[model samples]
Target: MIIPKNIEELASYAEKGKNVFFFTADWCGDCSFIKPQMPEIEADFPQFNFIQVDRDQYIDVAAEWSIFGIPSFVVTNDGEELGRLVNKNRKTKEEISGFLKMVEG
Candidate 1:
């Protein structure tokens, strides 16, 4: 599993290809819960890119992207957002897999 260090890395990923993103903060309980399980997700989708953005550090980026909740995900292709799973306890590997299937399709 890949957890990006900062927004620059996240954008660098976007420049390459379609990607899967996770917007999370180190202090988030839900993010902590899902961290270990991310390998399972990575094993399933080797082509997708997973990124992490610190909510506390990148509040403006989060707000600009309209991410009002923690543990949010955005899947995009060619700079267009195909789908997003925002909060709602959708922080599990299963949920992430499901979102990927829907958006990457």
Candidate 2:
């Protein structure tokens, strides 16, 4: 996964395909915990492209996307947001995968 700090950076990844996803902030406890587990999750789901963003660094971007919290996972295809999981205290590979599958499938 790569970290993109701004919308311009995100737009480039969007050109690649529908697998583009953005993870918001390091401050969210869930995101902090999820960080360590992401490598394994990436390994299991090799088809997706992931990007990390700081909520504070990109507040405008988050608002434009209607993100209301940190620990948000905005799954997008091309330029469309498929589905998002934003800090409901659920963080697990299985749980996240099920959410993505619901959107991507």
Candidate 3:
């Protein structure tokens, strides 16, 4: 996953192609659990570019996207958002795969 340093870099990714923006924070336990499982998820969905955004590092960007929780995901294609899975709860690998499936559909 590409870790974007700022909003501009994040935007640049979506502008290039379809991408999944994963919002997370270092202090978030749920985010930590999901981190290791992301590689498999990425493998399953190779069509979409994955970008990891640290909410703490880019507070304003997270606010702009209305991502108030850790472990949130948003699918975007050329800067247009297609879907999202945003919540405060911990997510399983299955749930993450399901979200990608939804985006594929």
Candidate that scores best on lDDT? 3
Candidate 2 vs candidate 3: the lDDT winner is 3
What CA root-mean-square deviation does each model show from the true structure? Answer: 1.9, 2.0, 1.0
Best by TM-score: 3
**What local lDDT does model 1 show for residue 88?**
46
Quality of model 3 by C-alpha lDDT: 0.90
Ranking of predictions according to TM-score: 3, 1, 2
- Taking the tens digit of each residue's C-alpha lDDT, what string does model 2 give over 19-55? 6455566557777777787787777667788777777
**Model 1: residues with Cα > 4 Å off, grouped in runs:** 1-7, 88-90
How many residue pairs of model 2 clash at the backbone?
0
Model 3 agreement with the true structure over 22-99: per-residue lDDT tens digits: 999999999999999999999989999999998988888889999978899999988888899998999999998998
- Candidate 1 residue 66 Cα shift, in angstroms, is 1.0
Tens digit of per-residue lDDT, candidate 1, span 1-105: 455677786667656666776778887888888878877887788777676677777787778888888888877776778888886474778888888887767
For all candidates in order, the CA lDDT equals 0.76, 0.72, 0.90
TM-score, structure 3 vs. true? 0.94
**TM-score preference between candidates 1 and 3, better one:** 3
